[model samples]
Target: MSGGIHADTAPKPVGSYPHARRVGDLLLLSGIGPRIPGSDAIPGNRYDADGRLLHYDIVAQCHSVFANVRAVLEASGARWQDLVDVTVYLTDMAADFAAYNAVWQEYFPDPATAPCRTTLGITALPTPIAIELKCIAATGAGARR
Candidate 1:
């Protein structure tokens, strides 16, 4: 059986999808952005009414993104330490990787316990956000085939 998890504290998905899904012992999270819940405001993004990019702050964006991820994890009965893998997408790698890495380290702390990660540079996202996260977590329940 499978179940979906929606976090009231996290931004509502832009598409028709839940924040996460549980299949057996794993919780698969949808791509999470840094947009504030309800307001739909994106941190670190500065755009005009015409929807043009103005400026971006990678650190601030990372903080909000991580927090949003945590909210979904908690809602799904998972924890940061339960995360097994993560996929990160960045709109501008050359300019943002260093700052993003620094902020990421603040959460993972120890390399040994950190989840495996793969980061890629992308051209754009659904919103004006600079970064997003897709995660998989262990649910601590027995696996079912």
Candidate 2:
């Protein structure tokens, strides 16, 4: 078993974690924040569809949060189809539940490609960040091969 999938190149890690790591057949990713690439500032915590900030709407945060997930996967030379499992940690479950699912569907448009998932409600996260996603993906050269 090759048990390895190297990135084309590595990006600057966000915090105290590697961007992604390959173990055996699995590519494991750390939780990504709402910050976009090339910037340290995180995205809006809450905003409307039209880009108006909303104090109580967490839907906006969920979108950016998942976008960050996509960024990490792309940087690691994988796609959403390679994903086998996901673990989501949320600080505010009630506010984020609906937003999470709706935005998730947008990214994971195909039900067949959907990964097994576990979403947990927690009291707090690293920042006031409402959502964070960590994922496991099997690469073609490894298990998916």
Candidate of highest lDDT: 1
lDDT of 1 by residue, 41-89 (tens): 8887788899888998889899999999999999888888889899999
- In candidate 2, which residue ranges exceed 4 Å CA deviation? 1-14, 46-57, 141-145
TM-score of predicted model 1? 0.93
lDDT measured at residue 121 in model 2 versus the true structure, 0 to 100 = 94
Task: Record all residue pairs in model 1 with backbone atoms less than 3 Å apart, i.e. clashing.
Answer: none
Each candidate: RMSD: 2.8, 5.3
lDDT of 2 at 36: 51
Q: Give the alpha-carbon lDDT of every model.
A: 0.90, 0.69
**By summed lDDT, which 10 consecutive residues of candidate 2 come out lowest?**
2-11
Model 1 CA deviation exceeding 4 Å by range: 141-145
